[model samples]
Target chain A: HNGSVFHPGTIVFPAALATAQAIGASGRDLLVAAVAGYEVGIRVGEFLGRSHYKIFHTTGTAGTLAAAAAVGHLLKLNPSQMLHAFGSAGTQSAGLWEFLRDAADSKQLHTAHAASTGLMSAYLAKSGFTGAEHILEGKQGLAAGMSSDSDPSKLIDRLGTRWTIAETSFKYHASCRHTHPAADALLQVMLKQDLKPSDIAKVETLVHQGAIDVLGPVTDPTTVHQSKFSMGTVLAIVAHYQFAGLQEFDQHFHDQDICSFRDRVTMVLDPEVDSAYPQSWIGKVKVYLNNGEVLEGRVDEPKGDPGNTLSRTEITDKAMRLAAFSGGASPSEMSAAIER
Target chain B: HNGSVFHPGTIVFPAALATAQAIGASGRDLLVAAVAGYEVGIRVGEFLGRSHYKIFHTTGTAGTLAAAAAVGHLLKLNPSQMLHAFGSAGTQSAGLWEFLRDAADSKQLHTAHAASTGLMSAYLAKSGFTGAEHILEGKQGLAAGMSSDSDPSKLIDRLGTRWTIAETSFKYHASCRHTHPAADALLQVMLKQDLKPSDIAKVETLVHQGAIDVLGPVTDPTTVHQSKFSMGTVLAIVAHYQFAGLQEFDQHFHDQDICSFRDRVTMVLDPEVDSAYPQSWIGKVKVYLNNGEVLEGRVDEPKGDPGNTLSRTEITDKAMRLAAFSGGASPSEMSAAIER
Candidate 1:
């Protein structure tokens, strides 16, 4: 089970549209290809060791290859050509961790590139060109070159039996993944204590090293991208609104009161939490109220983590919500199509 | 001076088209924007140190930022907004050493991504959305995060006094950049001796570390992508046809004799030659003839290197030659537009 904030439909739909159009494939074929792609993409992401973050972005880079494999399968490419397609996909693989630097657009574009390039690689392979046979295991192969260490057998290691798409997390907010646990914990504490922004003297967050490395010290983030990655901003928004979602990404997402409240929130890095991350996306939130009240909440596992899975209905609701913002699709329509 | 291969017209044309369409910018505005983008992209690549087999592909990552800056300048985005656009581009920045793993399609796609993403960031900023401001200089900036080290000052170091496009290398062959020097040397030797492929017993190539890392070993390459990155295949194509270009990348480009001869050629890594690269893109070739004779040729600098630059007429000639193969616009038309 993984804590990725992507729903099956959202991941599969965009990929299906691009794959179908590129190959002149039918809509039904496209849907089947997308479901297959989502399954492989999630599995590859999971098989990659949990600490693989130091090497590559599992979603965009590995996801692209999985998507390519699905397109290859749908196009009915022979085994040899399918391997070539995977090789081509491997060569095209890209998505750097630097995106977390400022909540850059690369985060979104990584998906766009993976979807488009995976489709393109499949089409190119279908045009009768060959690729490497041992792309994944060669001396200078994908795993050898990109990953410091990887198990080649993990690729086909129980592929059809276990599906990765079933294990992914569906995001309820559009913030950095690392910030979700803290945001979830902070929201719970505020809700339980009925805390008001003015009544809070200080809010202290004890989080993993990775969290602070990713979303720490929000000193005047002037842009939506920066605010989205800021713990201070997320906590402030939560304290003020009692929730965090896409609305928090608006241009005027931050107000003076929110900014003032954000200044009072300090994040302390805890090594114990740092060691447990990816395996346990835990967080601890301590709130100091102005009325001399102290409330604390510790989340060993966030709601979206595989440990606490969202129902299909809940996933459909979030997808529809996002689709409404993305335009031209409704939740029920998407759910029906996905169900098929 | 940069050693990267880029056609000014090719780079400028696509960049101009996307930026103009996205911002509703027009004629003269588009032209100025293209020129500005070319200048910035080239300069940024140059400032990132020199291109090598191991370093990140500078063109795509730095080029995206430069293109964004150019678009921002044309659209007249304020300093803060322009910086955010740069930050947005940086976060989205990607391109890896693994692309050279087998000269995959992702190689070309990198350029397309840079062009498209740069335009996308500028368009987003134009529509009044905000992005990170200190994407380059923040505690976790692009330079500090992506590469071993980056000089943010290089971005604005020589804002206007320097011109980068003026120094770019226009490729003479369709293969990987590292293989160019050796291919140039092989062609020189073949042309001088006027020897047929059958007359050659064995071909020995001495090249730099970068070349070896990219295209060493005559071992089999099952696909076109792999062959393009193979020194053996490149030398085979060059020895057989006395040239390698875009036409040779087509489906019917391979010949049995070339493939056979490619197997006969042995490539060795020369530390002496490797040390001279970037500063001097030189390669040495020694051919053992069938009749107990040895023929040798050394190319200190390829034709497209900045020192031995291709003139406007030469560039046009090259474009026209490529256009003929693709049934696209004539070189004259491309040259005319570029001159304008």
Candidate 2:
């Protein structure tokens, strides 16, 4: 499977669900459409990675490709029509990292925008509206404008044979996926040693230089975004709270002991780990205890990776809990209906 | 007024008409909205002009800016809402120049896409969905990714007082605006001489280098686009037919005597004219007649330029002709109703 920096699910679900509803498709059809959506999106994202990520959101920029491919497939578009879809979708592609500066909900908006634009592109192409034939590799095109260094072969090489969705990672953590490895590593050390927050002298998390650039400042987080991105705050929350729950991002946790202990945490750049990233998001953590004892944990790949997927029971339980929290019926009744 | 490579009317009219119809706005409201739309769109287009034009159609790229501004004005959007409208619209901006190669209907499609996207942006912003605050001028933004040479200060400078629509040109010729000056010069020469096509020996058109670059190859055109962009074909049609009407672009005229005579025409580059262009679309035509007479004609500005605005009677008469040609009733009755 091709590697992408952004989660394909955030892009695929919005497009698939919207298209499914529009076409009166079944759940199975939605799944198949989602698969195509994920594959196309992931490949385009992987192709436009690095330089594109420096300025734009992979979810919005490359996600349009996924959406168009998936919806176009569902509509049984001819190759010419498909090309037009890509043309229109490529021209429309846009999303920016600037939103992250304001912690704006524009992140969600980006996904929605991609979904709708993809739908529009497909519909127009189907109606015989022409788009650029060489939107990706053309001299003056998306990659040329959006990427400083780009390899378009990544977009088509082994396209049909390689199924990116099958290799996608699932997430159990509430914070950003980037923080999951460190959180997993830290939790394991504390769990194995049976040590409380008071037993720790200081905590250090080591990962790739790329990770440090993304998750930085190893300091207290004043906002939810800061908590999600800052390794120090994420690690502090995991170690001190003994769990990395959604509530950990709340502002009420600001005055907690974890926020102060977050200052003691340091993030280091390990070249070994640095060489592994964007392909492998690995993390290693070391803890010094007040009792003059040390514990260490390392994770090459965090839980929920394709190699270490969550069990069916765990997934069902998580689903039920989420449904109940979102004002659904009792978990047992909901499960029964779903099963039926 | 800021200059835009794409006609702002295509973008402005679609968004304004749709939004006005929905909101029950009067003609005055639509006009005001259109003015705002034209100004904002023109500024953004000028900023992203060269590099963006290489790949993207200016209509689809900058048209969104115009649509959003115009519709957002009619919707009474505040500054922050307007910002979000721009944010979402810019990300959704896309249209490729590849359509030009095919002479496809996608050129018109780009305008429609901008109209809908602009409306959607305004609607989403009004609903409190957040978008990037500095979408245009941000470090990682539309200008950065879309243009190799971009200056975003133009987006806000003299935004209100400098009216782009006021300076807008209203094209009367059937062909592309680039061909207008040459057509005007040719028609003037023909009218002065009262000459038949057989009377002409050879023809030479001297225009700015910029115009030559856009309208190339002094040769016969097989397609309407070629006729529109070719200096020779346009000159032949204007001189022989004595009019550059819409019907002259039809394929029936491809085998006409003018097509063969088009070979007698040549285009020249004038450095003085080149330096004056985009601001001035001037062309000089010199014709050598078989009757041993050389007639010279020049036009400093085409018929539709703001400096040589068409009179109200001329505008109304042209509108009535178009309306009647498109299945409207008698001009007198239609004009009376329109005036009311």
Candidate 3:
């Protein structure tokens, strides 16, 4: 595990699963490819920098390489073929932050496209198609177009030594990762006080400044998916529903409780928390109670962080519940697949 | 057709053909989509600018949008659905100039991915998936990530009044468009002087400055496809074989005679040619004979230029030859498919 904060799961998870199914690859190959996805993808994410993040999503950019690397590994591509695969991947690399301003379901499509494209790139290379060898550092390369500032060393340093998948932390809340720390901090407040949503007059959350571009201004999401990015909606869901999970997201737009509570919940940038970012994405929650009592809580990191991991039981419970929810079948019909 | 210089065939041709096959759209719809591809793609390409071309192939970038527009039109998509299609297409838009450096078969791949992605985007929109509405103009939109300078008005101005596809011209030379003018100019030189490759000591060519970027400095290509971008190889193939056609490209890399004359040719910038660039892509060729005789020729526009259209018979001959070269089945097997 290394010290990168990018999320490789969106890129690697869908990519590996799809490619594994397509090729009938072994579990070992799948794991190896998934790991390669994280290592290769997250480092590329770092090179793209915060400036690139202002417009492009790393999952679409770096994710293409991750998917290609994983699929290429499974295909047993030689280095030259892999370079060609990367060349095609780089040429097709794209994902924009513009979707954040729209209520479109493009978020899911991003992962789908990245995964399929990764497989496609690998297949293209296997068919004897050559590609740009120095795709990363070429004059008209990903780095040149996407980012003015990037560290090539970060992309290649400890290529075989560090396993970045080890550093990847899972999400406990189903909302956007940026909204998690605030929701997590508020979860503690709700638990410790045992206060109902009505008992809270107003709620304020403190999050790092870097989240402004991502989770800003889209507070009144018309669609369920959009609610995930709305810090207000995420906090309101946590306050009223007690858990921010798949059901909560599905109900975000229609639920009157979440809607009403959303207005009372607000976020402000905290200098202290902003300084700690992105090394440590911290959140501070302040609650004004109707009973004239104020409650404050802080969390350096959200649940399931590398430093604060979910228990094996918790993860297993989530996986089982998610499998049941997303995968429609009787328990008898699904148990074997779920267990595997 | 409009005055925009972007190539629409790579984007619209595949996209319309595939979508037409998929949906059984009317011939009218297919033609409408192709026209939409040229108009929409060229405008988007304008916004992307030449700087973007340094990194991305416009066929893959603006081309994706063109494909989507064409597919979306055939699908009878409402304005909202079309917006979503564009949104999804923008997210996946990519193609790198890096491939040109590697001489990879990525050129074909760019067109393939653009076509497939366009079909995929439209299909997703039809299925009710959301995409960015302001994918081109949004804060973190395609223009932001791909280009530093853009003219958004060009993307929408006189959309119906000016048809960009009308300006589209065919290529007589089988090489890249940059090499076409030179190849055309050389054809005249060979015909006028009845010269052989052995009779030539050194030859010089004058082409637009922009052509320098496309056909520059790739003198020793190991593949036939790469030879398309090498101005020397294109010229030599014309000089020796007396014609630059698909069959010639298929044989360029392996020919010893073409390789021998490749070294004898060079390119230099001509201010007169540079000034007439987008308005007219002209080439001037000067052949110095070993016998101390000099032959010169100039072509203001290559064969198949809008002002110099290839004869319908010539087009049909090329098409028939190409069909026979690539199609492996019997005439009856093709008849059933060709009838459709």
Judged by lDDT, which candidate is best? 3
Which pairs of residues collide in candidate 2?
Answer: A91-B94, A92-B94
- Quote each prediction's TM-score: 0.76, 0.83, 0.88
Highest-TM-score candidate: 3
* lDDT of model number 1: 0.66
- lDDT tens readout by residue for model 3, A101-161: 8777777777777777877888889988778887787777888888886678878877788
Candidate 3 docking classification: medium
For all candidates listed, what's the TM-score of chain B alone?
Answer: 0.82, 0.87, 0.90
lDDT per residue, candidate 1, B88-158, as tens digits? 66555554445444444555655666676676677677776445566555555444434443444666756
Model 3 chain A: ten consecutive residues of lowest lDDT:
A1-10
Ranking by DockQ: 3, 2, 1
Worst lDDT 10-window in candidate 1 chain B:
B1-10
What lDDT score goes with residue B279 in model 3?
62
Over 4 Å off in model 3, which ranges?
A: A1-6, A18-24, A186-210, A252-257, A264-276, A284-297, A327-340, B1-5, B186-209, B252-257, B267-276, B284-298, B328-340
